[model samples]
Target: MQYPRKSYRIYFILLLIISCTGERSTNSKNNDSAAHNRTRYFYETVKATEDTREKIIYLDSALASIKNSRDTLLPLLLDYKIFYHNSLKEYDTSFFYVDSLISLSGAHRDTANLAKAFYRKARIYNYLGEQEEVFSNSFESRRYYLAAGDSSQAGRRTLEMALAQISGGDYLGSQETATEALSLLEQEKDSVYFSSVHNIIAQVYHERELYNDAVPEYRNALRFAPSLSDSLSILNNLALVYRDNKDFDKAIATWDEILGKADSKTKILRYEDNRAFTRWLKDSTQDVETELLDVLRLRQELDEEIGLQASYSHLLKYYLDKNEALSRKYSEELLKLTRKHKNAGMELTALQNLIPISPLPQTRSYFQRYIHLSDSLQMASINAKNFFAKIRFDEERKQEEIISLEAENRIQDLEAQRMRTRTLIGSLIALLLLLALSFLIYYLRQRFKREKIREVHKTESRISKVIHDELANDIFNVMSSLEAVAPAPVVDQLEKIYLRTRDISRENSDIETGENYITYLKAALTNITPRDSRLIISGETKVNWSRLQEEKKIVIYRVLQELLVNMKKHSGAKLVAVSFAENNKFVEINYSDNGRGLNWKRARKGSGLQNVENRLSSLNGKIEFESREGKGFRVKILIPS
Candidate 1:
């Protein structure tokens, strides 16, 4: 559907207003102490004002109060600070506050609170262009959210991760992540988050050029976003999709709606110009001169109002194309405006125009300037691509660490619950003495079972820490340094050595976490090169993750993890592939690596490989590994969840 251009302009204006305002509300305070009470009061007073200036005053007052109070108030104060800093685009300051909140949450053993801090940190990292850090922090935040039983946040984190993947050009990965996040949001009845998930789904579809599928998802985003502001941007994007689909009428209708809601005079003018241009382009026999004149006039008007250098350059080009006089006037205006903004595109355009119009004495300087700007723009594009790749790589690695940590936490919770079950059984036996002697013996056995669980949890915790604390940190540090230095490809490969070391560390943990686990597999894959890494992920049409028993899910996760690990460890070939096929009765996973094929007949099964076999066996699953001397290894496992 076409959105009015007015909608787009109105949305930005509202966004600006929101960005400028701040407040601290007393209602949000814990109400635990007199100081908290006062702080809350001060906050609410500021927040109550609709006036932007008054709101700022309240924020400043609240901030001062928090700074003067006990150290206990630091988290509260920093939270507000983060809010304002983010609004102001002070990302560095915002991140510092988020980090402080995380540390405080850790000190207090507040897992849920810590998760929020981490989530904010991830958001800041995203804004700062630190894609890897954003992924890692977001993963950690999701882990903590799950730990805190905050399923909504957990689901949102998944959505955010999907966005990260999409932005990194991992469309397949994004599709999978979006599917998972959507399922969670649907279950939670979270309209806002559900809308976000749908938006990501649409984005993935769009990125993959699957317009047929994307259309429905975009419609879903509009359905859920009841607010005009919330839906406008997506509406604009949908219009773009229609434009891509060559549905000119539909695209124009969408733009019409955007124009309807536009609040700013400047934006409305720009929108009119775009619409006019699009319309002119669509008509085969349109008068080019008339169109050019219209566009040039629009640019001149906006240029004077907003100092838009691009418009000035555009006007200069249009005049030059017509071989008309007054090119010098536009050129001079573009140069003056470019001096203030230093906008590369406008500057480049101006330089190119100057190449043709320059006085005989200054032509060389114009050419040199053009060449220099072109090179800089080229370098910038290269840097952007590399930065995007690094973000994707880092995010995937961070996800592994988060999964491992969550697994350990889940093990501990299960152990605790088992202990309680045993205690209850024992107490019941105590009431019946002789008649319950058999029951008492069973109770004792259950206690032993619980103790076994505790032991297992302890082992898992150690392994989780190895990856979470030791390996993740080391690899992250390496990623950080690499980003800081922008090394050549050869140096980049050497830096990747640290990433390989991290893989080994995660692998070492896999021996205890169970073979073929998702976390282990993901970690192993992140360590390998794209040329060497193969990814195949498939599942049932609609797997009910929440309904499945935890142990069963973990088992499936582990099986896949182990298979991938072995692939990375042994696969000499550059290709890896995975496929999931399901029938009415069973789900099958096929993992293949183009490494030295494993010979099931001649291979000596290590403890880790054997353990994978055993876990699958417990689930009534069968495993097969087929590999020949020069071929790659392929492992197929079938199980029911």
Candidate 2:
């Protein structure tokens, strides 16, 4: 019965569009100035009017006035038409005007107008729940916004994109987009938009059930809120997050603050209901049922469908364990309201809630409806994600094509320049010859240095093997022979020497290649892992080991071996998990362990860690460490494939 409520994403988008008038300006010639003024007056009148019918009449008058004017003002007129039709919920008419606006703006290369047109199209598609169209138009809008040098508009479009991504269930992508938008808005120093971005980020985290991460983001939103109403809305969101996180005291306190400031009767009732629910969570002895019923009466009196739906949902959940008849009654009411609103998400929840409390004869029908709705919702979500992915792929492909065309043009230009330079080639032959001789000398010196380094490594490997095979075995034999009579200190010293020699041997060992490389790597880790600890490996089988070069493999093997050795020596770890994944360009390895983590101040000075860094540097790779004392340790390594 814990329904995932829909956010006020559309409200924010609408607020942004209405409040941002700076982006609307006429760049038409003096000949059209009179028409432009008349159009602007009519548009302003439409915006100022509260009555939808009057707004429509003003929009029509503006469109009529501009019909005979030059095409310079056509884009603005089409925008008005689209906005009017959208407000009237005449989506098909809105879509037609959007198409007309895009066509007109594209013909004139009016990037700013085109951006607005695409943004309007995205908003229309969002209302229609056509998420694929929403994302496609949003991307186009963002591109045109950037082309128009409107970074603020582009940042807002990015927030819209993030919302589309969230609706498609791409939380990771949404979070990344939200972060990018947040960075842009911070640079712009626009407090209102910054708060909106923070709210989007918080919603992403909240949807992902990362309540701890969501809390600070909602607080940040509240800190930046421009108006008292906006602040109260953010406070309510924060309270909801706190309640979900089981911080009942904070949730109740936030609701109290909201109730004190909220002037609208519906808002006051909603906050009171929220407070009652939180108190019930803190202590079940509270009269949550009576409080919810009172709120329901007020919502019913106000004809607040959304608020009524919420009250019914809460009452249904409250009665679920106590009275099946009352549960069914409230569930039916919730379903009716959700159906009236055509809220598929809440309808799905209502169906789920009803299935359990339904009568035995009707249970099968309810189950069937739930399954059908769930599958349809899932498919819709999948289609939205696929459409967005396809749009991105197409965009990237077009960019690559443009780059290829530009590269060809550059090559042609360079070829023509080469022909012109042919006449001067003979004069530079002597200079070129001198430069080639210098390059040869440098290459020889570098090759000689590399050969010397190779010889040194070979010598070390030979000495290490000799110590490991001959000296280490002899020492172990001596220690075993004297075990009964040897003092404890002497035995300890011998054991330390044996371990050091073994480590040296491992450090100098050649990397295993061919088909057995992964097996060899696993064996190396197993040797160092403690018997009481667990080591889990995943995704190793997914990588194509043959694609990796010998040098990279050697570096990776050495680094992982060093980490395991360090863990075994110093960390009292109970569990370690390592996962490997590869994309087209990079092989990523994630390593984590439950252990006494590194002291960050001293971790950089460790010789073993330094060696790891050196090996990674040689392969042009990178390693990132995340750990705190008494917490778990984690390392992420990325190397070119």
**TM-score for each prediction?**
0.44, 0.57
Residue 414 CA error for candidate 2 (Å)?
2.3
lDDT of 1 by residue, 155-180 (tens): 88888887776655556666777787
Tens-place lDDT per residue, model 2, 1-641, is: 12111332342233234334343345534435666678778888988998877887887677655523233555676787788778888887677668767766775678998999999999999998876678778899998988888888888888888888887776777788788787655444677887888898898899889999999999889888999889888899899999999999999999987888996888898898888877887887776888888998988889988888878888887888778898889988888888888777888778888887787768888788889888988887777667777777898899899999999999998998897687468557867887898899977765554454455457767988898999889889988987889998999899889888887787676657678999998887886788999999899998999988765676677788888888887788999998999999899999999999979659879898897887676556899999898997899999889
For each candidate, what is the lDDT? 0.66, 0.80
After superposition, candidate 2 runs with Cα above 4 Å error: 1-71, 186-189, 423-641
Model 1 poorest ten-residue lDDT run = 1-10
Which residue runs does candidate 1 get wrong by more than 4 Å? 1-74, 85-96, 122-140, 157-217, 229-235, 244-249, 253-267, 288-641
Error of 2 at 17 (Å): 32
Residue pairs with backbone overlap in model 2: none
Best by lDDT: 2
